[model samples]
Each structure stands twice: as structure tokens, then as C-alpha cells.
Target: MTTSPNAPMTSPTRRDITAETGLPYVPPGTIPAPASAYDGLPRDTAVAGDRGWDRDSELSQMSKAVIATVFGLALLIAAFAVIGRLGGWAADYGTILVYLAFFLWMSIAGRVFWWGADTLIAEIRKKSNTGDCR
Candidate 1:
């Protein structure tokens, strides 16, 4: 493992490091393989933060938004149906208004939900002291 002082240093491969140290070698600038069964588990449930937890949280939030939007649409339909039965301007133009309102509501609600999820994740990471904010 010794080199001449005048020799140029070259990047070492994983195999070279492994052979020299007799241990598992991880390449530079790469995450190492987990050392134990509990590695990479969620911080709340385990000793360290899960590297993919943010991705899972995002997917969960998207599914929730979809479900909420669907439920909102159903309720809007039911309300519009009841109002349209009253035989007023509602019956004539309420469909367009309802669609517009639904879109607006979805945008606002989705943004809020996403923001809240991000904030919660950030707070959890902060409290756990397991994530590098940078």
C-alpha cells in the first residue's frame, strides 16, 4: 500500500481498496451498502433516516390528493344535482361554475397539502438529526 513520494496518486478502485484493507470497499462519492438489517429504516421507526423516505412521502401525498379530489368531485356533483333541480339559473350555468370552482379548489388544496407534507418531513428530519439539510 506504500508508494514512492514522487509517484502520482491515482484514484483507487473498490477492488484495490478491498484487497488492501481486507474489508468491503466503497467507491468515492458513493453511498456505502448498509451494514445491518436495521440500516436505512425510517428514523421514527429505526436508528437512521430512510434514504427513500421523501420519495415515498411524495407518492403518498399524491395518492391522498387524488383521493381527496375524487371525493370533492363526487360531492360537487351531488350538490349541483340538488341545486339544479330547483329550476333556476343554477340549472343553466351551474355546471360551468362548478367545474371552475372545482379546479380552483383542487389547485389550492393540492398546494396546501404538498406544502404541509414537505414541512412535516423537514421537521421530522430536523428533530431526528439524521438528514443533511444541505
Candidate 2:
């Protein structure tokens, strides 16, 4: 909060920062926001900031893959049971089980990919900011 002697300090508080920038102050190390803080904004929660679509797309893809794998396994199991009872399909059981296992493995792989991507992006951001020294 220090300013050069030649520079005039007009605003002194978080309220003043909000008034000047139209951005609210979120306390450090907290995620859940109280209702009173977001009363008049368009959304129920405050925006943390934007990370661009590459990050967003990776996250979305990971979520969709996980959900698809879970539901796909359930559907395959049900289909196998029905086929085994109605029409003899014992020959296909081993293959379907393998596919289900592969999908589950893919879900875990997707998680690891997302984690690595996030870590790389964060490191890049940190390096870029660290370069802007006085």
C-alpha cells in the first residue's frame, strides 16, 4: 500500500478499489462466498477471473469423459444381462468386460491429463508474472 511521494493516494480501502475498478475483493484462502456480497450482480457468485478457453475446454472434456464412462459401463452391464437371459451372448461377455475396463482406465487417464495440463499452465503463468520484476 505504499506510494511514491510525487503520487497522490486518493483511495485507501477495499471499498475504494471496488468503486474504482468495479471489481470486488475476495479474502485470501476462501472459496465460498456469502449471499450478501453477490446481491446485485448478474450471477450468484463472484467470478474468480478468466483463464481462456483452452483451460475451460480441457476441463469440460474431462468432465464429459468421466460421466460418459460411468453411464456407459452401467448401460453395457445392463445390455449384457439382458442379452445373456434373452439371447445367448456368452461369447461376447469377455469382450464387453474388456471394453468397460478400458473405459474406466480412460477416465483415470483423463484425470491425469487434466492435472498435468493444469500444473503446466500454472507454471507458465507463474513464470510470466515473475518476469515482470522492478
Q: After best superposition, candidate 2 residue 114: deviation in angstroms?
A: 1.3
What are the per-model numbers of colliding residue pairs? 0, 0
The Cα local distance difference test for each model comes to 0.62, 0.58
In order of appearance, the predictions have TM-scores of 0.29, 0.29
| lDDT tens per residue, model 1, 57-123 | 4655445555655565565565556553544544677867766665676566566555555656656
Cα misplacement distance, residue 33 of candidate 1 (Å): 65
lDDT by residue for model 2 (44-112), tens: 343567333444245554355455556556655555555534323334566677566656755665555
Q: What is the C-alpha RMSD of each candidate to the true structure, in Å?
A: 20.3, 24.2
